[model samples]
Target: MTIRKATFDETQRILDYALVVLKESTMGFVKPRVEIANLIMAPILADGGYYLIYEKNRTIHGWIGVGTIYDSYSEEVVGTIPEVYVFPAYRGQGVAEKLFHEAFRHLKTENVNKVQLNVFAGNHAKKLYEKIGFHDVSTLMEKDLD
Candidate 1:
């Protein structure tokens, strides 16, 4: 398998994968998957961000979206990994790990000091992220109103 930056022409395909990830990972806290996917992808496609695809024999198996963002609390620029997904059949084969590391290497080139990503509670990928050296820095608590 090989990993590479996705082209602008490929944004919609990547967004399709992103929608699946959001649906599975959001735990219903977010709504309207299509709009959310577009919002997350627009900045990356416009500039200052990247979308990477993992493929084997020219067939895509997974993708990741990353970029740099200013963190007001930290008062420094931080690398943001906003989306990561590997097809169900491709899971457990290290695709996600490779995607993350590749994203990290790219971010380092941009001179970012640290990287951060959000994970919803009960998402199994949280364990994998921890294994990859990500630690909890803060929690986002929410309340549902009727």
Candidate 2:
């Protein structure tokens, strides 16, 4: 498998695959009306972030997106991984580990002081993140009004 950065021309394909994963894992609990491709592209075009994909034989198997967050109060820049998804067929095959390493290599060059990501309480990937040196710093809770 090879890891590479995604191009803007491939935004729609990426968004489609990502949306499927989002819906399946979250049980459609989280829905966004805005074009997610825009969110993925904005950071990359701004030179502040990236989206990396894992591919084999010209087929995309998984992807991870990291966005930049600038803290005005602390004057610090951090990398935030908003999404990481490996296609169901590709799960448990180390695709995510490879993708994370590639993303971190890029982030390291940008002098990002830290990286953060949110994982649902029941997602098994949280263990993978922990094994890769990520620790829980906070808990996020939400209440649905509708």
Candidate 3:
């Protein structure tokens, strides 16, 4: 398998996988799911963000997005891993782990002081993230009223 930078031509493919990842892993509060997904991802490429894709035999198996976010509390620019997804067939083969490490390495080159990502409660990848040294800094709680 090989990992490399994704091209603009591959944005649609990345969005396709991102849609699946969001549907399967998140309980987001948004309407018109497609638009929401696009909104979250569109700026990545336009503003110098990037994704690293993993592939084997010329077929992409997974991807991870790497970008920057200004940390209001710390007053510094930090890395934000907005998304990570591996095809179901490729799960359990360390694709996500490799993507994450590569993203982190890239961020280090950019002088990023830290990195963060959101994990929905009960998501299976949460364990893997913790294994990679991520720890909870805060929590978000909401209650719906109707």
List the RMSD of every prediction in angstroms. 1.5, 2.8, 1.6
* Candidate 2 segments exceeding 4 Å error: 25-29, 32-47, 72-75, 143-146
Q: Write the per-residue lDDT of candidate 2 for residues 16-115, one digit (tens) a residue.
A: 6655656554544567434653464456447656578898999988888877787565678888787788888888899999999888888888888788
* Per-residue lDDT of candidate 1, residues 31-84 (tens digit): 746778788767755667878899999888888898887889989999998888
Worst 10 residues of 2 by lDDT: 32-41
* Best by the lDDT measure: 1
Q: Candidate 1: how large is its RMSD? A: 1.5
Q: What lDDT score belongs to each candidate, Candidate 1 first?
A: 0.85, 0.76, 0.84
Candidate 2's TM-score: 0.80
Clashes of each: 0, 0, 0
CA deviation > 4 Å runs, candidate 3: 27-32
